[model samples]
Every structure is written in structure tokens, then in C-alpha cells.
Target chain A: MNRKLLLAPAAGLLLCCFGCQDTVNTVENEPQEPVSNIRDVRVVTDKFLRDRLIIRSVRMATAASGNQVAEVAATNARTGVFSQAWSGITGENPYTVAYKFVWMDEAGMAVETNLSAWRTVQIKPGETVFFKSVAPNARCRDFLLNLKESD
Target chain B: MKFRLLLLPAAALAALLSSCATDSHYVDATDTTVAVKNKNRMSSSDWVVITQDAGNALLASPLFEEYLEAYRIDAEAALKEAEAAGEKITTREKLTAMKPLLMLSTIQNNTSEHIDSKLLTERLREILFNSGKVRFTTYAAGEGQSIDAATAQARQLKNDPNIKKRTALKKGTVHAYDLSLAGVIIKQTAQDGRNNEMSYTFNLTLTDNSTGEGVWTYSKEIKRQHKQGALSW
Candidate 1:
């Protein structure tokens, strides 16, 4: 009876650990529609973050006011929920990401403005989210987006 | 064999000590990679985010686009007509005259927090002013004036005899505002079991002073939540 009791608790612990790995299933159109994705150069310093957060595409548009707007589609590919939860130095979950858009003028000089501030978004495992922003002014023709793991 | 064992523990101790040593340094205030310290209240980072969101939205709105387009077309037409009529009015004057005058108005705060509304308005004013699409009037009649309380006092100096006649400002020079900007901040709170959530919404509108109609409106909401310990639940 004592052995059975110990086995029961051990089995329960095993089940909890194994079953806590959360993931999602997704479906989309078989033939994906054409998107105006731009060719972007990337510098990946954090391999772990880049591996877990996959960037799908980057698109650009010009508004009527002559300001440039950028949209980046990214997904969280983390398959282990319990193992990754509260793993950040600040106890932040890996699912939350902070990003900012730095704008530049035609001369490649950084255009300083209040619009270039850090913003954050939450993406569940296997879910995709788009980060969008308009340039600070019409003079801002180019942009560089910075991303980091955030709480 | 004994020496190898001692080296293993010494290396491990060094590694452990290195891991525990944290360097305190100054980082860029605008850097996005800075670790967040608190999420429950409005911090400097929150202000930065809010300023960016609201400023971008207002500057990119369709109404502001139309407003600029109308001014451009009108200024060009006026310049062409003046040139044909052999008038001496410069293009710069036409552009300046056509630029719409806006006055800052009251921003009602309905939130429980003692939030400084200037954090939003000042940043917005800087962005809009730098755009060069609109102008702000220092004084408005009947309605509230801009944040500069010195406009009226400066004008009152015109009556002072001690002031030079050439440097003194003329009467009837104060231009009335063509538009006014106003806003409101609202807060909502909820609790479920051990979880607490707070939401704040900022709503702003630009009203045409002549027609008394809101020409542009925008709103943004920020939500934050914190869950207590598992035992609390």
C-alpha cells in the first residue's frame, strides 16, 4: 500500500511536468496571398530569443501625410510553457516582447522625435502579432526596429 | 589526483563568484532593452509609450492629412492669383496666413491617480509644432487660452508709456484660434479572485473653433494586471 501511494504521487508529478508544455495548432490558406515583404538585414545577438520568437515578414507603406509606416509580423514559437515561465532576470515571461522603431531621414541621419519610444506586445505560443508604427514626421523616410524580451 | 580535484572546486568557485557579481552602470534612458521594474503604475517608460502612440496617431490621422492638403491647395491658388494680378504678396506670407491656428484647452482627468496631463499635452504640442502644419495661438477669447499665460500680459504692456513706441506691439494684433484641442483621461479597475487589473483610456479631440465641431478624435487604452500568489487564490 505504501509503495502504491509513492507511485501515485510520482506519476502525478510526471504528468504535471509533461502536460504543462503548452502549444497551439494553426491553419491558414493553402495558397498564401502575395505580400510586399521587404528585404531586411538582421543582426541576431540573442540566439535563444530569436529562436523562440520567429519573425515572419516586414512591410512598409507611405501614408497620405507623407509619413512612412512599417509593420512587422512575428510569432512566438516557444513549445515549453512551464519550463520557460518566469525565466527572465526580472521574472518576466518569455511571451512578452518589447520593440521600438527608430526613424531616419533620407541622409541616413537618425530623426529624433517623441514617436520613437519603446512599446510592448504579448504573443501566445504559436500565435502571431503585428507591430505597426508611423514615422514621427514626413522627413523620416527610413527606419530601424529594435526588439528585446520584456516583461 | 588530489591537485586535479582541488582545481575543479576552485574553478567552480570562481564561476559562481563571477555569476553573483552584478555591475551597476548608467544606461540610455531611451534604450528599450532596459528591464522593467514595475508594471502596476505609470512609469517613465509608460509615458514614453503613451506619447509615442498618441503623437503618431494624431499626426497620421486622415483629418490632419486633409487639413494640410486644403491649406496647400489654397496657398498655391492664392499665390498664382496674386502673381497674375501683379500683387507683391510673397509665397511665405500666403503659407503663413493659411496655416491654421490652434489653441490648447482643458484636459479633464477622471482617474483616481494624480496624473499630470502635461506629460501628454506637452509632448503632443512639440510634435505638432515641429510638423509645421499648424500654428498655436497664445491667447483665445471667451474660451480658455493656451498654456502661455504671458501672452495677455505682454499685450497689456502696449499701454505702458515706458516702452519704446517702435518696439511696442500694436492693438488688435492677437489672432483668434481656428481650432482647439481637448482631452480626458479615464480609469477602470477590476478584481477577480487573486488577480487585479487596471485599465486607463485617453480620449482626445480637435474642435474647429468656427464651426464648434470636432474635426478629429482619437483614443488609446492601456491595461495592466497582476496575479497574487497561488496560496492567495
Candidate 2:
């Protein structure tokens, strides 16, 4: 009887673990033209933050005025791994993250533009979000994206 | 001794409570993670975000680019004409004389709370001016009286012999604006269960003075929600 009781609790714990794993599913149309002008960079700090906000790819394009435009694709790694950990512990609630883009010139100086404001967005488990920004002027050649957990 | 022990516990409790209180410290104004006490009213962070978005959109808009190009061509032509007419004008004078003037119209605040929309307008004006695309002029309810007073003062200064010849005030030199910027900020509130939500929509329109037609219009919405009990209604 004791063995059966132990097995019952063990099975229940296993079921709970598996049941809490709810990940996001997405369907997107295939692009006719492949993405070009993607630049690769190194991520050195904040491994924990990197695991949560995974930047998949970055594509550069030109605006109508010949200014540089960057599109960044990032996914929530926690949503894929933890999969509704907060909702499982408490109740159904969305998680929000704040992000901002900093534009830079050819001389590596930060552009004095008004595009550097924190914007908040809510993401589901394992969902990928695309953030886009245009250079303030033709002088901007590079960009840095900053992201953080929102309250 | 027992009473003394009771007093010791009370002192400890008081210390703990004081420690739990929040301490005053400096924080970044641009950081959006900081919790705000009033969710229904517009905050400084909201103004920053809204103005940034507006400036970015305006700078990227094709209409603004077109305006800049047209203004450059007109400025060059005007400079050439002034030089041909034997008017001794510097390059800066010619450029400033041709730059398009923008006047600030009314910014109606349709919210229940008393909000000085100037906070928002000033940021927008600063951004637009910094972009090197437009110039702003002050327009208020009693601006006519101020302009008349300034005109009278200029007339008196023009006759004053004490004034230097080079610094003499010129008559009929006021530049009229070619464009006007107007906007409205509307706030809406709703309640669901124990949660209260507030939405602020900022709508702005740029009108051409000659045609009285809106050349560019943009709107930005910011929504904030908080627990009903957390903030007093």
C-alpha cells in the first residue's frame, strides 16, 4: 500500500510537469524572395537575457529616401523552454517586454534622433516578434537593440 | 524585565517597518519599467514615447521630404534674385528668409484631468525644429495683442537715433506662416471587474495655410491599466 501511494504521487507529479508545457504555434507565409543583407554580430554579455530574448535574424533594407532600415526577428526563449511557467504557478496572464533601438552613424556615434524610446510589447510562449526601425537620416549606418523585462 | 522585553520587540518592529518604506533615489526618466501612481493621467514617460514616435514618423514621411526639397530650390532661387537686385544679403539671411514658417494652432485637451498640452507640443516642436525641416512660431489666445505691442515698439525703435544704424528695426518685416500644426488629445476610461483601463489618443494634423488642406495627419494611442483598488478613482 505504501509503494502504491508513492507511485500515485510520482505519477501525479509527472503528469503535472507534462501538462504545464504549453508552447506557442505559428503559421506564416513563405516569402517569394529570400532575405539578403543580414549582418552577423557577437553577443558577449547577459547570457540569461539572451536565452529569454533570442534574436534570430536581422535584415537591412533601404527606405524611400535611401536611408537604412533594419528589421530584427526575435523570439521569447522562455516561452519555448519554460512554457507558461508563470501561468502554471498563478493564473492566465500575459508577459510583457520592453525594447528600444539606438541608431548609430558611420563614425560609431549615437544618432541624435527621437527614435530612441522604450516600447512595450506582450508576447506569448515561444512567439517570434519582428521589430523594425528606420534611420533618422542618411547618416545612420548601424543600430543597437536594447530589450528588458517590463513591469 | 518582561515589560522591558516587550518594549524591545516593539522597537524591533518599528525598525523593520521603517526599513520596508521606500527610499528616495534617482532613476532614469526614459525607463518605462518604473511603476506610476496614477494610471488614468498622462505621465512624462508617455509624452516621451508619443513624441518620439511622432517625430520618427514625420521624418520618414514622403511629404516632409518633398517639402524640404521644394524649400531648398526656392531658397536658392530667392538668393540669386536678391543678389541680382543689388540687395547686400548674407547666405544666412537668404536661407532664413526662405525657410517655411510653421504656426502652432490649438491643441484641445478632451480629458477629465487638467493637462497642459504644451508639454507635448514643446517636445514635438523641439524635435521638428532639430530635424532641420521646419520652423515654429508661437500662437496663443492673446498673441495678437503681443504682436501689436511689438510692432509699436519696433516703430519707436526705428526712429530712435540712439540705436545703431545696423541694428535699426525694419517695418513690415514680419514673416507670415505657410503651415499650421494642430492636434487633440482625447482620454477614455473603462472598468472591467477590479481593473480600470485608460486610453489616450493623440491626433495631430498639419495644414497648408494657402489651401487649408491637411498635408499630414498622424495619431498615436497609449493604453494603461491598473487594479481599481490600487489607485483611487
Candidate 3:
């Protein structure tokens, strides 16, 4: 039997390549928490959002999360979910929002901008958000994107 | 060459363990626009005390010298009992004919912050309007008169069917000489149903003008959960 059907598709492609390398080393060795309630913090202006301008938010429940259920403990921000494609917006939005992120080093240059650092966000009143630039300085691998117009 | 000196001490111990490795990310800090540390909340002032100036409101507080030394020792013991009864009274007319005072204070949210109960009631109405001896009002500072345009401009200056008319409707005290300062802000939370070992109370009782009946009572109890890590305990 064709050598046991090519060794049963070579043992199902070697167990799908070691089960995708054991799920990327168990998600880079789990455990990660520290980022505060950046609400509906939007800004995705998709359309392939050149220079990457599609960052969305969801995760803001603390007063020590007790009995959880802030819409079921929505800590959203494990990044990785993008289907892209959308267009819609109009009225009652005079404009007033702020965000700016940039930091890169690791021979990639660009850093030095932390005037006693900060980053808090929230936005909801007809949502349609997006955000960009994450790599919040872990010796920053690279990132940059800013948006202004809030007073 | 012993394998290029063992590959230069394994590339200098892999560049000294990748320059003391450390690269993991995720930081929100309750992102209320991230200035971190309990988003926003750090007021100096954002007041409001107009309930028809609650009897010359002011005495907002730094214990306005403890209510001006308890209203100058209750107007020097009611002017030595009106000068031993000879009665020629007038320590500012016996502190404006006493019987209108109610003092109290305790608005502690001692910043580890979750403030903005209107910035601790606008710094307790600027310390009870610089404590001129309690006569404050600040239910969000509103009451510049308008219960139907002040009884329709006091009924057009007591009526005027062309300057002169009778009692087609003229009564009195439709809400006059009113005042209010109300109380409470004490906070210590274990989350709603409360009790994570106790310390959570948020009870605000605002008042201004006609909601009257509030001679003064302030309270505080913000012990934002025995902090830790940023350190405190």
C-alpha cells in the first residue's frame, strides 16, 4: 500500500510540524499583565491603513476586577485579529482625540521621548475605532504613529 | 585554532545574554488617556456655589481658621450676653443675629486617586469659600434664580396692568431666603456589594438653595485598597 500511503502523509506532516512548534512556545511563555483601561480607543482608518493606522482597544476594568463581569472581564489586547475592510462615519463628531506612539531601538534607532511618560484612552459615542504602534519600548523593535486634535 | 577560541567565548556569552534580556509588552493602566496612576484626578479648583450665594457663601476651607475661630467664639459669647442685658447689641449686629450656622468637614479621597466626584466637590467649594465662617452652597453651583424666571420677575414688580393693579394673584414666600450645602464623599470600596475586608463608601448628598435644610456636614474615607507594589503596606 504505497508504503503505507507515504507513511501516512509522513505522519501527518510530522504532527503539523510539532504542532506549530508547540504553539509558538506556549505563546512566548505566557504571563503578561500591565496596561490600563484604554477603552474604545479607536483609529483604524483601514483600507490597508498604510503605515499601519488601525489600532482598536477594549480592556478597562479595574478597581481590582472583583466579581469580574464588566461585560465578562473584557481584557482585550492580546493582539492578532484582522480581517480588514470597512468605511463609515458621519455627523455629530466635531473632532477631539489624541494619541501618539513611537519608539524604536535595537539598532533601529529612534528613542528618547518620555517626559515622564503617559498613555490613557477612552472613546465611545458611535464607535468605529482603530489604533496603531505597539512595541511600547521593550528596547523597542520599532513603531510610530501619532494623531492629534484633542484639547 | 581550537574552533576559533571556541567561537570567541560563544560570541561573548551571546553578547552578555542579549544585553540582559527583557522584552515583553502590554501596559494599559486603566487607559483614561494614560498619564497613568489612576488617570487624571488632581484638582486645584473647579468650583460652583450659587444657590443665591447661600448667605454670602465663603468659608470653603483650610478649616477657614476653624470657622473663624468658631465664629469668633460665637461672637464673643453673644456679646457678653448682650452686655449684661443693657442690650445695645452690635458685634456686627450680634454676628448678624445668630441662629444660622452649621459646620462640619471630612472629604478625604486622599489621592491614590479615583477622584472627580467633581474634584472632591470642587475642593469642597474652595475650602468652603475660604471659610468666612460657613455660608456655603454648591450643589454644582446653580441657582442664580429662575423658578419660572423668579416668580416672573416678582410678578413684574408686583403687577402693572399699565403701572398699577390689584391682587389678581399676589402671595408671599414663594421660596425666599433659601440655602443648602449638603454632604458626604467618604469612599472605601470592595466593589459594589462591598467588603473585601472593608473600606469603600461613596455617598454624596448635594444641596443648593431651596433643597435647604443642611447646616453643614462633611465626611471622607478614601482608602484605595491597601496599595502595594507602587508600595504602601
Candidate 4:
């Protein structure tokens, strides 16, 4: 009787783990044209947000007026190894992240632009969002994107 | 009995002091994560967020590219003429002279609450002006509470005998604006038994003064919600 009681709770816990831990699965056709990606250096201060969102890629381009622009794609997936069945479940809480972009001049000093305001966005457990920014002027040659978990 | 009586008064004094405790501190002006005391009203941080988004969008628009192209052509032609005449002119001077002038117009507020439209317009003006891409003239447009009356008053000094003729402003020297910016703010509210929600929409347009056509337009929406507890209204 005791053995059966122990197995009952064990099976219950396993089912809860499998049902509650939901993940996202995505698919799309491969790109037809070539694309360029910029290598990025990151400084992580918030491990909680870092665990929830993954930076997929960073793309850079120049506008017609000589301003630099950047686009970042990030997915809300925790770092882990899970079974394929995790993707089929749908019972996870969404996470809200606040991020900002600070532009730097060619002299490597931070540019004083009003564009560097923290903006918040909510992402579901398995969704992706893109953050984009344009340099205040052509003199801005580099940028840093800061992200933190929203209160 | 004496010791117990003294303890009772000390404890009472502690309780009274604790009840009157106050909390006040400074926060970074740029920090946007601060909690909203009232969800219905927009906070200063909301103004910051909206201003940056809308201002950046306008700067990145294709119309701004056209504006800069025009300035480039003008600057180049002016430089060639100066060279032909054996005159010297700096790049900064040429840019300032050739850059387009923009005027701020009225931003109508269509919300239940009394919102100062300057919260939006002034911030937008500051960002666009500091970008080094455009300049603003004291010459105002339709219904935008103008600060230009001071300039006009100063010009009237030309008539005053005390003012030197050369020190007073010239009558025909005022530059007309090349572009104007105008916008509107609207809000929607909802309540479902316990939670109160509000959504604000901001729309802005940049119009070419010479062509009388909108060169760029942008719209942004922000939503906020608050839940009432058992003791709250």
C-alpha cells in the first residue's frame, strides 16, 4: 500500500511537469536571398531576463541619409534541453521585458539623443519580437541595446 | 508595576512614530519602470517613451532623406558660388543656412482628462531639433501657443528712439518655415467589474509648407490597466 501511494504522487508530479512546461515551435521557408548579420558583444546584468529571452540575430543597414540602423530578433525561450512534447503544451505565463538602444558617435562616446528611452514589450513563452532603432544622425556609428525584466 | 507602566508608554510612543513615517526619494528621470499611482492618467515616463518613438520614426522616414538631399544640393551650390567670389564659408555655416526650418502646430487633446499638449509637442521639438537634422523657427503656425510674440515685441524696439537703428531687427528678414508638424491625442477607457483599462493613441504628421502635403505621419498606442481590490472603489 505504501509503495502504491509513493508511485501515485510520483506519477502526478511527472504529469504536472510535462503539462505545465510549455514551449514554442516555429517553422518557415528558407530565405531566397543572402543576408548579412553583425557580430555582437553583450554585457549581461539580469540573468532572469537572459534565461527567458535569446537574441537570435542582429542586422545592420545604412539609410539613404547616411544614418546607421539596427534590427534585433529575440525569442522567448529558456536555455534548456527538453522533449519535443514540450512544444505541444500551452500553459506558460508570458514575460515582459524592457529594452533601450544607446547610440555611440564615431569617437566612441555615447551620443546624447532622446531616442534612448526604455520601452517595454511582452512576449509569450514561445514567441519572437523584433526591436529596431535608427541613429540620431550619421555621426552615430555604434550602439548598445540594454534589456531588463519589467517590474 | 512602575516598570510595566513605563514600557506601556514607550511602546505607545513607538507606535505613534511608526504611524507617521514618511517615504520620499529621488529616482532617475529617464527610468520608465516606476509604478503608476493612477492608471487613468499618463505619467512623465509615458511622455518620454512616446516622444522617443515618434521622434525617431520621423527622423528615419524617407521624407527626411529628401529634406537632407535638398539641403546637400543647396549647400554645394552655395559653396561653389562663394569659391568663385573669393569668399570663405565654413561647412557649419552652409548647413545652418541651407537646413529646412520647421514650425510646431497645435496638438489637439481629445481625452476626458485635462492633458497639457505641451507634454508631447515640446518633447518632440527638443528631440528633432537636437538631432542636427532640422531647425525650428520662432514663427508659429495654426493655434500652437506661440512664444513668438516676444520676438515681435523686440522688433517693435525698432520704432523706439532709444534703440539704435542698426541694433533693431530688420522688417523683411524673418525666414518662413519650410515644414510644419501637427498631431492629435485620443483616449479610450473601459471597466469590467474589477479592472479599469485605458488606451491612448497619438497621431502626428509632418507637412511640407511649400507643397501643402504631408511628408510623414506616425501613430502609436499605449494601453494601461489597474485592478481594484475588495476595499477599493
Candidate 5:
């Protein structure tokens, strides 16, 4: 009787523990994805920042009048990483980076322009790299820089 | 004695079944686990900024500093007027006063083109409301209080002739607030350039607090031409 009693309860307990389960949606190689990204970035501010981006020329034209652009200088590529860290965020876990550029005129009006390449980059841990982007369109005179945290 | 021995096992089995324990079985949705998440990626593509040597060279000029300083002041002032009412003040308040209300995530449209209006709008809305400046409202009263054709005859003696007057909030009627902001990403570039260089323009605007006019506007332009021997990103 004693043996039977112990076996029955023990068996039940094992079944309960073994049956408990939960699910989570996850994948591997997500590291290749950036930790953070910025969109709608408008201008480039710092001179030190100018060195980090790879710029390329695109086939685009402009309107007869200089105020508006009829075509754009499409960005052929962008950086996988750009910039420093802040807010106790560093390295691979909460990686921080950003990029930006500005638009200006020959007379420097800072006119409203349809601009910016929506690009994102992912940097591996312990890797130092620069960022790049092409002008969003023709008639872009100035650029701004944006550095943001990466996931 | 034999029966008693068997009773022990039976009692143990019963005890195990009745124990405060749980097991999985094919059951209704209520029995399933539910997950809650912020939906923002912890790691995403980093935002990059690129500049040209000429863009950098101009920064040494005094004008860039002056321009940036002015915009910094404007940004601080407007932000203060809206949020300064609630904060602990100290020395260097202007530089360190504003508090972060919304934890922003870079809204991305991983799809090829820039079709991120939905994400952008939602993020902006989150920023506005998260600041404690606005709250959500369903305004269910519109459906319940409006008089349909069935009740149209009951309003014949209404004193107010203006349609807007009827819906006008009474003096003491509690009303919720409405908040919104307009932000556009404007872009422009050079008319002539063929040296494998990149140039861009950014035109940002801040509107008036009261009249909704473009109170303050600023532009920063940067260009980078990669010289054969020069450093470029």
C-alpha cells in the first residue's frame, strides 16, 4: 500500500511538470539587423561627421528654375554602422549610432526640399566602421547628421 | 490486508490528481498563454549620417556655430514654454531641464521604398500624447445625443438657430483637449555635380504656438565630394 501510494502521486507530479509548456516567437542571426535606426533625417551638422559617409553620384536632373528639383540623386548604398555611444548604451547590446545631412542653395536659403535616404546599418560587436548615403535629390546644398541607438 | 495495500496506492493516485498542480491539454483559448511586448526591436538597422570634405571645411567658419546656436535656443525656448511648467529647477536649467516623456523607437519600413507614413504618424502621436499634453477620447455622446428623424419633432422649439450653437459646449461641460504637430522631411540638392560627390539640403520648420504659423524655420546644408586622396565614408 505504501509503495503504491508513493508511485501514484509521484507519477502524477511528473506528468504535470512534464506537460507544462509555453511558446515564444524568435529567430537566429537577428544580429545582422541593426539595433536602432532613424528616418526622415534632414541635415548634416558636424564637420567630423563628413568623413564617415560614402557618397555616390546618381543620374538625376533639375528643373529650369533652381528652387525645385524634378529628379533625385538616388543613394546606391549606405553604411552598416555610424557613430558613438551614450546613456550607458554601448557595444552589441544597446548599440548607439546615427547619421544626418542638410540641404542648401547656391545663395544658401535653406529652402524646403524633398530629401533624405531612408537607410539603416547593423554593426558587429568590436567592429569600427563608417556610414554612407547618396543625396536624396538634386539641388541638395546642405546635409545634416543623425546618430541613434542601435538594438 | 491485500485490500488495504491496494487502498494505499489508490489514495496516493487520488491525492496526486487532486494536488494544486496544472497540466497542458487541448483546451479553449482561455487556457492558452498570452504574450505582451512593446513591439519595438531591441536591435535594428542603425541610422547613418555622411558628410563631404567641403561640408566639414565650412564648419570651421563662424557662421555654422552661430546658426546652430540660434536653432538650439529656439528649440529650447519652445520646448520650455510647453513643458517647463513641471520640473525641478537647478543651475544650468536651460541645458538640462526637459524630461523625456516618450521612449522613441526608429520606425522602419524594411520594404524597399520609403512607405513609413503609418509608423511616422503613430510615433509622432505617441510623442504628443506621451508628453501628457493630450489624451484619447471616443466622444460616444455624438451617437447617443444626436436627434434622428424619429426625434426630430422634439427640437422644433430650440432657441439656437446656428447649427454649431447646438453642439457648442455648455459653460461647465467638461471637454477633453486635442493636440497635434506637423513635421515634414524636406529635401533638395545641387543642380550640377559630377565628381562622385554627395550633397543634400534639409529644411526644417517649427510653427507658431498660437496662430499655427511657421514661427521659426532653419536649414542646414552639407555636401561631400570624395577626393582621390581624401578620406570619405
Candidate 6:
């Protein structure tokens, strides 16, 4: 009887862990020509966070006003729920993240502007979210994106 | 002795609670640490998001690019007309005069909470001005009058030796606003059992003052829900 009781709880726990994992499925048309202006960069800090928030690619294009525009595609790589045992409350994978963009001039110096602000975006497991920003003026030729977990 | 022992424990508990009290800390206004607390009222974080979103939308719109182009065209035409009329208007003057002036009309706050919509308007004005595409005229009539009177006074004193070195002030040179911006913020609330949800909708419109027609319009909605006792303030 003791063995059966132990097995029952063990099986229930296993089921909970496996069944709670969430993932997304996607379908797209045939691959088109790759964009030439897309840059490849390194991500070096916070391996756990870097894994959860995966940066897929960064692309740049010219806007109508002759200013540079950038788009970042990031995916949520988390797979399961992060639950609090005491409160019996569950949170979905890929928690809310806040992001901001800084514009840079031709000399790679940051362009100072007050219009930029941190914006919040939520992503689901395995889902990709695109963040787009435009340079503050024609002087800006490059950009940087900063991301952090929302408190 | 038993009563005294019980009191001792109670006093110790109170001391512990006092020691555990939270201390004040500073957080950046743009940081995510600021979150919505009251469902019925707008928070500073909400203001940041709304202003950012509005600025982004306005900047990305084709209308904004067209507006800048139209200013250049208007300046060139004005210079040509002045030259034809035998008035001496320099290219530098025309270049400096191409900034399109915009006026803040009204922001209707239809919510129960007392919100200073001027904050949003000011943020918008800052963004538009920083973009180098537009300028803002004072919303106060009294302020406008004062500025006009000051400009006239400065023009009268232009020939004074003390003021001769200063830039010449001119009357009737103030660009009248070609565009006006107005908006309304509406709050709606709904309750379902222990869950209360609040939605705030901000609707903004940019209109051509001469034509009295809207050139660009945008609406942003922010929704927050609170389950009673789920969060501690």
C-alpha cells in the first residue's frame, strides 16, 4: 500500500510537469531572398535569460524621411510554466519583458532624444515578436535595443 | 506571571513587524518597476507608454513626411512671391521660417478620475518639436498676447544702440498654426465576481486648421485587470 501511494504521487507529479509544457507551431511561405542589411551580433550575458528571450535577427532599412529604421525579431524559448507552490498561482512561459531602442549617429555616437521610452511586450513560448524603431533624425545611421524583465 | 509572559511575546511580535517594514527606493520613470495599481486611474507608466506609442505612430506616418515636404514647398513659394512683389526676403530667412506651427486644441477627459491631459499634450509637443518637423504655439491666449506684445516692443527698440547688435524683431511674422491636435481619453470599468477590469481608450486627431478636416487619427487602448486580494499594494 505504501509503494502504491508513492507511485500515485510520483505519476501525478510527472504528468503535471510534462502536460504543462507549452509550445507554438508556425507555417510560412517559401523562403524569399535574404535581406542584405541584416547584421549578426553576439549575446553574452545571462545565459538563462538569453535562452528564454532568443534574438533571431536584426534588420535595417531606410525610412521615407531618409532616416534609418530597425526591426528586431526575438522568440520566447521557454517551454513550461513557472508556478509558485505556496500560492498555487501559475505564470505562463516567456514572462513580460520591457524594451527600449537607442539611436546612433554615423560616427557610432548615441543620438540624444527624449522621445524614446521603454515599451512592454509579452511573448508566448516559441512565439516570435518583432520590435520596430525609427531613428530620431537623418543623422542617425545605427541603433541599439535594450531589453529586461519587467518587475 | 502568565499575563506578563503573554504580553512579552506580543511586544516581541510588534517589534519584529516594525523592523520588517519596507524602505523607500528610487526607480526610473521609464523603468518597468512602475506598474499600474489603481484600476480606475491612469499611472505614470501608462503616460509613458501612451506618449511613446503616439510619437512612434506619428513619426512613421506618411502624413508627417508630407507635412515636412509641404513646409519646404511653402517657404520656397513665399520667397518667390516676396521677390516678385519687390520685398527683400533672404534665403536664410525663408529657411528659418519653414517650421510648421501646431496648436493644441482640447483634450476631453471623459473619465471619472481627474487626469491632467496636458501632460500627454506636452509630451506630444516635445516629441514633435524634437523630430524637427513641427513647432508648437502656446495654448494660452494670454501667453500668445504677451509674446506678440513683446515682439512689437522689441521691434520698436531695434534701432537703439543697445539693441542694434541683437536680431531684428518683426511683426506679422509669427506663423499661424496650420494644424491642430485634439484628443479624448475614456475610461470604462466592468466587474465580474471578484475580478474587476478597467479599460482606458485614448483617441487623438490631427486636423488641418484651414480645411477643418482631420489628417491623421489614432486610438490606443490600455486594459488592466485585478483579482481582489491577488496583489498587495
Segments in model 2 whose C-alpha atoms lie over 4 Å from true places: A1-24, A32-36, A65-67, A80-82, A86-93, B1-23, B35-37, B74-90, B96-99, B138-156, B159-162, B230-233
Model 5 C-alpha lDDT per residue in residues B110-213, reported as the tens digit of each score: 22334333333333333233322223322211211211342233344245665455664344222222212233332233333334443344333323333444
Model 6: how far residue B211 lies from native, Å: 2.3
CAPRI grade, predicted model 6: acceptable
Candidate 3, residues B142-218: lDDT per residue as tens digits? 32211234554656665566645564435642322233333433333453332232333434333323344333333
Candidate 4 Cα outliers beyond 4 Å, as residue runs: A1-24, A31-36, A79-92, B1-21, B35-37, B67-95
lDDT of model 5 at position B51: 17
Candidate 2 lDDT at B191 equals 89
lDDT string, candidate 6, B53-169, tens digits: 787778777776776787678867887888899997766566666776788778888998888777787788777787787777762322112123464566677678787554777
Q: Candidate 5 residues A1-151, lDDT tens each?
A: 9999999988886565434311122333655543322233334554332333322222222322122221112221222222222212334322334433344545665533112323334433233444432232234544444443323
For candidate 6 chain B, the 10 contiguous residues with the lowest summed lDDT are B139-148
Model 4 preserves the real interface contacts to a fraction of: 0.52
Q: Estimate, for each residue in A1-151, the C-alpha lDDT of model 1 and write its tens digit.
A: 9999999998886687556545566787764754545778899988978987888888888887788889888878775635444333234443778888898887999878888777678777777888888887788788898888874
**On residues B1-233, what C-alpha lDDT tens digit does candidate 1 reach at each position?**
99999999999999999999999888666544464636456656666766788887877788778866775677578778977999877555665767777777778888767777767776787888877667876665222223566766876787899987788766766667777778888888888988888777889888877778787898888777888788863
lDDT to native, each model: 0.75, 0.72, 0.36, 0.77, 0.34, 0.74
Share of real contacts kept by model 1?
0.57
Error of 2 at B29 (Å): 1.5
What is the C-alpha DockQ of each candidate? 0.43, 0.45, 0.05, 0.53, 0.02, 0.43
Better of 1 and 5 by DockQ: 1
Report the number of the highest-TM-score candidate. Answer: 4
Candidate 3 chain A, which ten residues in sequence have the lowest lDDT sum? A63-72
Residue lDDT tens for model 4, A1-151 = 9999999998886787666665667786786744337778888887866766888778888877678889898988852324223433422356668888999999999986668877788776677888999888888889998888875
Model 6 — interface RMS deviation? 1.9
> Where does candidate 3 stray beyond 4 Å?
A1-80, A83-120, A123-151, B1-119, B123-177, B186-202, B208-233
User: lDDT, candidate 1, residue B212?
Assistant: 84
Chain B alone vs. reference chain B, TM-score for every model: 0.71, 0.75, 0.24, 0.82, 0.24, 0.74
Fnat score for model 6: 0.37
The 10-residue segment of model 2 chain A with minimum total lDDT is A79-88
Q: Give the Cα error of residue B6 in candidate 5, in Å.
A: 62
- Output the better candidate (5/6) by DockQ: 6
Q: What order do candidates take by lDDT, descending? A: 4, 1, 6, 2, 3, 5
Position B183, candidate 4: lDDT: 87
